[model samples]
Target: MTACVTVLIIGAGCRGKHYSCFAVHFPSRMKVVGVADPHTFARNNLQKIHNIDKKNVFNDWKAATERERFADAVVIATPDRLHKAPAIAFANKGYHILLEKPMAVTPEDCKEIASACKANNVMLAVCHVLRYYPASLKIKELLDAGAIGDICHIQHLEPIGFWHFAHSFVRGNWRNEAETTFSLLAKSCHDIDLINFWMGDKRCLKVSSFGSLSHFTNSHKPKGAASRCLDCSVEQTCPYSAKKIYLKLAEKVVNMEFEGGATAAFTMMAFTERLGTRKTTVYGTKGELFCDGSGPVEVFDFCTREKTVHPTNKSTVIPSQLMGHDGADYYLMDSFISAVAENKPSLIQTGPEATLQTHLLVFEAEKSRKENRVVFVETRKEHFP
Candidate 1:
C-alpha cells in the first residue's frame, strides 16, 4: 500500500460526504485532515470523524485553501457553478484535486481550470465515477480483448425516473440551466464521459439529441392541483406526490438522518427513493454489448450466435457492503487516494482533460436538441474560444 494520503474536503453536501466516507472506512489508508463548509453541522461532523483541529476547519473554501497546503490534496465537491475559483487557487497552490464533474459551468471556465492544473503540475482528477464500477471495468476488459470486436455506435439512456426528475431537475437544485448547468452536464456527464472513454480517444464526430420537460412543468399540472403535495386534494392520486418518498409528514426525514455529521440515513433514504435507471448499448461488428446499470451486462456474439451474461461485470465477487452504485463509488475514492499517495496521474483512466471533451459533447448534444440540427464535435484544439 502507498503512504496514507490526507484529503481536505470542501462542500460537505451530498457528494462531498459520500467520497469522504472512504476516510472513515479505511483509517490506515486515508484520512480527512480538514473540511470547509458553510454548514456548521457538516463542519462539526468532519472534525469529529478525523479529529480535525478547529483551526483547520472553516466555513468557506477560501479559508480552507488560504495558507500552507494543510493536506496532500483537496476534494472540491462544491456545486457545479462554484468550482472555478477554489479549483484554480488550489491547483496553483500545488495541491492535487479530486473535483466533481462538469469541471466548470462554462467552456471558458473549463479551459481555464485545465490550464491551471497543467501549468501548476497539479493532478486534477474529475469525478467521473461510473468508470470505477466493477461492471464497467469488466466491460472495458471485454472490449480491449476484442470481445465485442470493432465498435460501430453506442446508445445510452438515463431514465431520470418520473419522481426523481420531478424532484431534482424540475423543482430542485438543478431546475434550469442558468442556475446550475444544463441537465445533460449536471446529471449525465458520467454516461457521456464513459461513452467517450470506451471509444478509446476516437473523438465523437457529431451528435444530435431531443428531450424536454414534457410532463413535469406547470403546463402538465392538474387543474386545482395545489403546488405543495400535502395541501393538494389529489395528493394520493397525483402520481408525483412527495409522500411517495418522504412519507406521512413532509418535514419528517429518516432516522439518524444527520447523526454524527454523517448522512447515512439521508443517503440511504434518498437513494432508495430514486427509481432512476441508466442503460448503455455498445454496438460492435462481431457482437453487441448491453447493460442496465441496475442489473447485468450481456454480450451477444453474432458469429457464435450465443450470449454471455455477467451478473456483476464478470467480477469474481461483487462486494456486498458498499451497497451503492454497484460499489463504483468506493472504488473510485480508493483509487484516487492511492494515486495521490503515489504521485502518479495515471492511477485512473479519467482525468480533467479527458473529461473536458465529454463535457463538450454534452454541450453539443444540448445545442442539437435546442436548434434541431446536427452539431459536429470540434477537435480538442478547436475547443474553447
Candidate 2:
C-alpha cells in the first residue's frame, strides 16, 4: 500500500485553494493535515472546503512547523516576497517543499532555497504549471523528436489584455516594477522557461526589453477619471469596465466566484476601470503560442502551417474543473505524490536539474538586461536520477 503523504498548505489564496482541491482529488495517497495563512477568511474557506479541523489551521507557518506538524511536505503558496523564509524553514526541518512560481523574487533567493533543499535532502518543486499542459507536453515531445530541428530563437508574449493587466498588475499586487520585477520576470518567467525547454541546448545570449506602464499610468488617465472603478466617469462607455469583464467572467471562472476572492473580482474590475489594456509576445524558432484573455492554450506552427487549440477545462464541454492552472493543477500534484512515494525523480517541474535550468534563464535574462548584451546560457550535464 502507498503511504499517504501528509501535507501542510501555506497561503490560502488562489494557489492555496488549488492545492487543497488537489489534495481532495488524491485522498488515497495525499492528505491535507494543515493549512496556514494570515487571512482569516481564506483559512476558514480552506478548512471548510478540505474538511480540515480548526486545530490544523494556522496564521503562522513557523508555528505550524514548531509542533512537529502532521505534514510530510509543505506547499509554499505565500506571496512572492514571503517565499524564502518558509521554504528554508520547512526544508531545514526535512520537509519536502512545493513552491509557487518564479521560485523566489530574486535569483539569489532562489539559490538559497535550492541549496537548503539540496542539503536537507528535501525534494523541491516550483509551480511552473504551464509545463503540465498536455498541449505543452506535446510541444516538448515534438521538439525532442526533432520536429522543428534545433531551436534558434524564440519570441513569446503574454497579452494581458487592457483590463486584465490593469487588474493584476496596475491596481493589483504586481503593478509596480519595483514591487514585482520587470513585467517579464513577474509574468514572463513561464515564457522564458518554456523557451528554454523548447530551445534545448541554445542559450538566451541577450535580452533587450522595452516596456512601460503605457496605458495604465496616471499620466494616461482620462479627464474627470476617478480612482475607483465603481464611480469611474468612463464606466458606462468603456468596454474595459471592471464590472463588465470580471463580473461577466466570474459567472464562469471558479476562482473568481464570490466565495473565492470576490476581492480579486472587484480588484480586477477596478483596474479594468482604470488601465486600458496590456499584451506580451514570444517568438521561437519552431512555433508560436498566444493568450489574450485568461483562457485556453492556442498554438500556431509557422513551418507546417498547423494550429492546435486546447481549451482550458473550464469550458462547457468540461464544466467541472480543478484550480491552479486547469488540469495542470492535478498533473503537478500527481507528479509530486508519485515522486515522493516511489523515491524517484519527478517528470514534471521540480528536481534540481530542472530548477537549476529554469533559474539560470532568469539570471541570464537579468544579466542581458543590465549589461546591455545577450548572455549565453551555460550548459549543465546533470540528468535527473
Candidate 3:
C-alpha cells in the first residue's frame, strides 16, 4: 500500500526539518502537508520548499491542530518543555505522533505522554534516532545471533565536545535546566536508549552515574577574557571559539565538501574535536561491541578470539558521508513510515514504553549521582503502540 502519510510539522526548527526532509526524497511515501511554528520566516521557508498551502500554516501548533484534524501524523520537535500539550492534543485529535526524545523532560510528563498515546490508540514514536542507525542494527543483529552471547555490562561515554556542550548546554538553548532539562535528558537520553536497545529485554536495573559541568561554569571563565568569543583577546587560543566552528563550516560549504545544506551544517559541529564525543561499549557473555557516533562499529568474540569492523577504516572516527546523523535520521523516518503503512505497533525496537523506560533510567542515573548511591529501576508495565 502507498504510504500517503501526511505529516504536520509542529516545530520548524532544524531537527524538525531534518525529519521532514524524508518528504524530499520519498514524496510519495510521506509529505509535510502543514507546518505550525511561531516563526513566520521558518513557516514561510518551509512553505516555499514543500509548497504547503498558506491556510495550513499557523503560528501555533494548538491552533493548527484544532483547525485541521486530517493530517496523518504530527512531528513534535518543539522545545523540551513544550512537548506534552501538543502531543496530547494531537493524539486526542487522532494523529499518530513522531516525537523527539527525552519524551517530555520530566518523569510525570513522560508518563502523561505515554498514557495519552495508549489512551488514544495512537502510535507514539519517540525520536531515539540511534536505535535506527545501520551500525546499531548490525550490532543488534550480531547480539541476537549470539555473537555477543548473554549480556554482562555496558560502558557508554557521551563525549559532548567541549564547544558543543558550551554552545548547547552552557550558552545555548538547553543551557539552563530551569528552561529545558538536565544534560542527561536533553542530550544523552537517546544515547542511553541505544544502550537499552542493545541490552535487549534485559532492563538496566541498577544504575549509578557521575558527571557535572566541571568545565563550563562561571569560575572556569579565563581571566580577562570577555564573555563572547569575538570580544575575547585570547579568542584564537580558546579551544571552543565560535569563530572556528562557523568559519570552517562556511568553508566546507564553499568547497562543496558537504552535499545537503543541513548535513553540511551538521558536519560543521560534529567534525570538530573542539569538544563533542559519544562512545559506547556493550559487554556480553561471549564478546563485546564498541561503537561511537564519529566512527565504526567493532565486535570482538572471546570464544573465537576474533574481531571485526564494518562501514569504515578500523575503529577510527569517520566523517559523516551524508546527512541524517550517519543516516540514522532517514532510517528513523523510514521505519516510522513503514509502521504507518503496515499499521503495525512499530517497525523499530524503541517506542513510547521503551523510550519512556530509557528516559527514566537517565533520571535514575542523575538521582544516583546526586544521592551518591546505586539506584534500581522497577519493571515498566506499559508498552508502546
Candidate 4:
C-alpha cells in the first residue's frame, strides 16, 4: 500500500484554499484530515466546500495540533504575522510543515520558525510557488546549460497592477507596513527568490530599493472618489473598480484546491473584495519573464535575440483556459509533490538555498531602507544546518 500522509491545514484563507486544492488533486499520497481558522465564517466555508468532517475542524490550531486528530503534516497558510505561533506549536509535535512565505513578518520570527522546525526534525517547505512553475524550471535548466552565461546584474519589477495594489496593499491586510513588511517582503519575495535561484549560488552583493504608496495615496484619489471602490464615483471610469475587473476575473478564473480544504474561487473572491490587482516580472542576464496573472507566459531571450510566447496548455482536467499565468498553479503543485515523493530538494524554491537567498534580500532591503544606504547580501551558514 502506498503510504499516505495525513495533513492538517492551518489558516482558512487564500493560500490555504490553494493548498486544499493540492490535497484533493493528490489524494493517494496526502489526505487533509482537519482544518482550523479563527474566523468562523472562513472555517465553515472551507468545511462546506471540502465536505470535511465537521468534528475534525477546530477554531484554534493549537487544539487541532494537540489532538493529532487528522494529520502527520501541517500546512501553515495564515497571514504574515500569524505564522510563528501555529508553526512552532505543530512543529514541536513532530508535524512536517509547508509554510507560506515571507516565512514571518520579521527576520527574528523567521529564525524562530526555522529553528523550531529544525529542532523537531521536520521538513519545512516554504511556499514560494513561482519556483515550481514550468517556465521557471525551464529557465533554470537553460541557466544550468549556460543559456545566460555567468549572470550579471538583474533588474526585476513587480507591476502590481494599480487596482490590485489598491486592494491588497492600500486597503487590505498588507496596507500598513507595520502589519506586513514593505511591499518588497509582501509582494516581491517571489521575485527575490527567483533571482537568487537564477543567480546560482552567487551571493547578492548589495541591495537597494525605493518604493512607496506612490499611486494610492489621498493625493491621487480621483475627484468624487470614495474610500472603497464599490461606492467610488469613478467606478465606471476606473480601470480597477472591484466590480469591473477583479470580481469579473474571480468568476471566470479556474478553481483549484488549497491546504484548508477550501476552494480557489472563494479566496479569489475574497481578494477581489479586499484588494484588486496582480502582475509580476523577473529579469535575468539571459532572459526576462513576465506574468500578469491573466495572460500567456512571455520570455525575452538576449542570447537568441528572440521573444517566445508560451500560450496556455488547455487540454488538462482543470481546463488550462482558466489557469493563471499559463497554468503556473498546476506546474507548481506538481513539482512540489514530485520533490516530496522523490525525497529530493526542489531546484527552484522550497529549499534552504533558495529560502536563505530570498530572506537575505529581505533582510538587506529592510536594512537599506532604514539606513538609506545600499546593503549587500552576506554569505552565512545554512540556517537548517
Candidate 5:
C-alpha cells in the first residue's frame, strides 16, 4: 500500500487488457503481478506484455484465489455472468476489487458482491468509467455550484451505432441474454449510471423502459438473405451486413428524442446508424448543460442570457492503449489504483455503494421493460449495510 499497488488481471480480455495497461503506462503507481484467464492465449499474451511471473499466472480466477493474497488488488473483467463468484472469492481473499461494469448478472449477485467487499473491509470500484471523464466531473462541479440551478430534468442518449450493435449484440458474446445479460446491462449501464449521477440526490422514484430485438429478429430478416453476410446475395444492400458494418462501407443514421427537465430523467439507447456517440442535456432552473460525449460542456445561463463552453481537458501524454471512452478509462484506472493503494474506498466515485445504487436503477429499468409497466425504485442510504 505504500508504493505501487500490485494488481492481478482477471479475464485478460479486451477490458482486462485496457485496465491492466494502466500499470504499463504508469509503472511507478501500478503493477500487474498476476493474470488469470481460461484461455491460455489470453493469459500468455498479457503475461508476455506485463512480464507476469509464471508462478503467479493462473488458468482461471478460482485458481488465482486458491493461493494466499499476493497482490494488493484484482481487476475482475470476466464476462458478465462470471462476475459474482470470482468477485466474492477474491474479496474473501482480501484483495481490493476493481470490478467491470454490470457488477453482476443479477441484483442479488451485485448485492452479495458489494456485501462481501464491505464485510472484508476491501475497496470495491466498479468500472463506471463515464463518471471519471473530465467533462463529467466538470458537469458535476457546475451542478454542485448551482450553475444549472438544481437539475430538474435530464436526457441522455447512447448511440451504439448499427454496426456496433450488430458486432457486439447481434453476433458477439453479448448477443444472447441467456448467455450473458440483457442489452441494457450489457451496453447502457454506463449511460444509466451517468444519468443517475447527474440526478444528484433526486432519487429515481419510478422508471418505465421499452426496448426489443424488433429489427434483429428472424421476422425482419430479408428474403433470401444468407445466414452469413459473406454468403448473402443482398450483402451490398443489407444495412446490418457484417461486411458493411465492419468495413465501414456505409454511413450511420441515429434515432433521437429531446424534451426539456431538472427533476425528471430519461435515457435512450439504440443501435442505429449513429456510431458510438453520447449526448447529454441537463435542464436546470437557472441554466442548461449539454455535452455530446466528445465535445466541451456547453452551458446557457438564463439569468445573463449568455452561453459559456468548457472544453474537455484531454490527456495527451497517455498512450492510446491506456485510453478509451474519451480518455476516461485511464483516469478511472488511476483513481481505482489510488484508492487501493491508499486503502481509501472513497477515492473512487464508483465505489460499491454508489455503483450498487446506479445498477439498481438499471435493473429496475430492465424490469420495467420486461413487465411493460412502471417500476418503482427503492431508495437506500447505503447498499452494503
Candidate 6:
C-alpha cells in the first residue's frame, strides 16, 4: 500500500483526464499505468502524457478488462449509460474503483455495481467531488460542531449559468434524457448529495419534486429557428440560440422533508446569467448559516445577536486545467489516491454506501417529479449485496 497507487483510465474524456492528472501533480503518490478510450486522439493524449505502454492502452473498457489487472485501481469516467458494465467488470477483477457520479442510469445497476465491489473486497469511491471542496468541508465541519444547532430547514440554489446549461445540457453530451439521463441525475445529483451530507444521519422520509424540460424543448424553439444554431437566421436574437449564451431560467426544484422534521428545498436553474455560485441558506434551531459558495460562511447566532464569518481554505494552488468545481476536482482525486495508497477506504467520504444513499435520494426526487406526487424514501439493509 505504501508504493505508488497506479491507476488505469477508462474513457479518456474530460473527467478521465481530469482524475488521472493527479498522478502528474503528485507522481510519488500515484501513477497512471494504462488507459482505455475509444477515441484515438484521447487515448494517444493520455499515452503521451503518462508514457503508458502500447499494450496497456485499450480501444474500450471491455478490452482493458480482458487483460489481467495491471493497476491498483481503475477510474470509470465513461458516459452515464456506459458506467455499469466496466464498473462491475473491473470490480470483479479486484481493482479498486473510482466511479464517476450517478453510478449508473438505474438504481438496480447502481446496486449491482456496489455488490460487485463488495463481493470482490475491492473498495469503491463514487465521484461525489462536491464533498471534497474546502468550502463544502468547512460547512460540514461547522454543522457537525453544532455551530448552528439543530437543523430546521435549508434552501439551496444552483444557478447553472445560461452558457453552461446550453453547452452541457442543451447542445452538449448531456442534452437528451434518452442518451444519458434526466437533468436531476446528470447535473444536480451531487447537489442533492451535498444537502443530504449536511443533514448528517437524518434520513429523508418524504420527497417531493417538481421540474421538467420546460424551456429546453422543441415547443419553445423560436420561429425561423433552424436545427443548427449557426444556420438559423434568428440565432442572434433567440434566447436559446446555440450560438449565444442565453438568459438564466430555473430548471427544477426538489423538496425533501427529513425524519427530524428538517426540510430542504433545492432549486436548480439553467437560464439565468452566469452566476457561477451556489447560494445556500441553512436555518437551525439556534442560528442560521448563509454561504455564497466562496469566500467566507456567515453564521448568525440568535442568542448572541451577532453574525460571525468563518473563512474557508483558499491557499491550495490549483492547476488551470483541473480547476473544475472551484478546484474541488484536485482534492477529490487526492483523497482517492491517498485511500488507495494506504489501503484505507475511510479516507474517502464518497464511498459506495454513502453515494448510494444520496443517489437513491436523487432517484426518489426524480420519481416524485415524474409522478407528480410525493415519494416516500426507502432504504435497504442489503444495499451493497
List, residue by residue over 87-203, the lDDT tens digit for candidate 2. Answer: 989998988888887788776787788788888888987877666655456555655765444443333333345666656766678867676665556665665565556555443
The whole-model C-alpha lDDT of candidate 4 against the native structure comes to 0.63
Off by over 4 Å in 5: 247-262, 381-384
- Give candidate 3 regions above 4 Å deviation: 248-277, 292-297, 308-322, 382-385
lDDT of 4 by residue, 149-250 (tens): 444444333445556665676667887887676766777677667666655655555566444345556787789988777888799888768777578751
Candidate 4 residue-wise lDDT at 32: 75
Better of 2 and 3 by TM-score: 3
- Estimate, for each residue in 174-231, the C-alpha lDDT of model 3 and write its tens digit: 8688888877777766666766676666645566665555656678888888977888
Off by over 4 Å in 4: 68-70, 223-237, 240-326, 338-348, 382-385
TM-scores of the models, in the order given = 0.88, 0.77, 0.86, 0.77, 0.93, 0.95
Q: For candidate 2, what is the TM-score?
A: 0.77
Per-residue lDDT of candidate 1, residues 168-278 (tens digit): 866789887788887767777777776667766465665666655555667878888897887888788876688764674211111111111211111111223335356
Worst 10 residues of 1 by lDDT: 250-259
For candidate 5, lDDT tens digit of each residue in 1-385? 3689999999999999989988887899999999999898999999999998899998977888889899999999998998999999999999999999889988889999999998999899899998988888888888888997867777776777767777888898888889998888877788778776776766667677777666777798888999888999989888778887667651111111212323444544454566656888888889999988776889999999999998788667767886688688888988898887777777799988889987877887788777877776665864445
What overall lDDT goes with each candidate model?
0.74, 0.63, 0.72, 0.63, 0.81, 0.87
> Model 5 Cα displacement at 83 (Å)?
0.4
RMSD for each of the candidates: 9.0, 9.1, 8.7, 8.7, 3.4, 2.3
Best by TM-score: 6
RMSD of 6: 2.3
lDDT of 5 at 342: 78
lDDT of 3 at 265: 8
In terms of lDDT, the best-performing candidate is 6
Screening candidate 6 with a backbone cut-off below 3 angstroms (N, C-alpha, C), the clashing residue pairs are: 247-271, 248-271, 248-272, 249-271, 249-272
lDDT of 3: 0.72
Worst 10 residues of 4 by lDDT: 250-259
Stretches > 4 Å off in candidate 2: 247-324, 363-385
Q: Is candidate 4 or candidate 5 better by TM-score?
A: 5
What TM value does model 3 have? Answer: 0.86
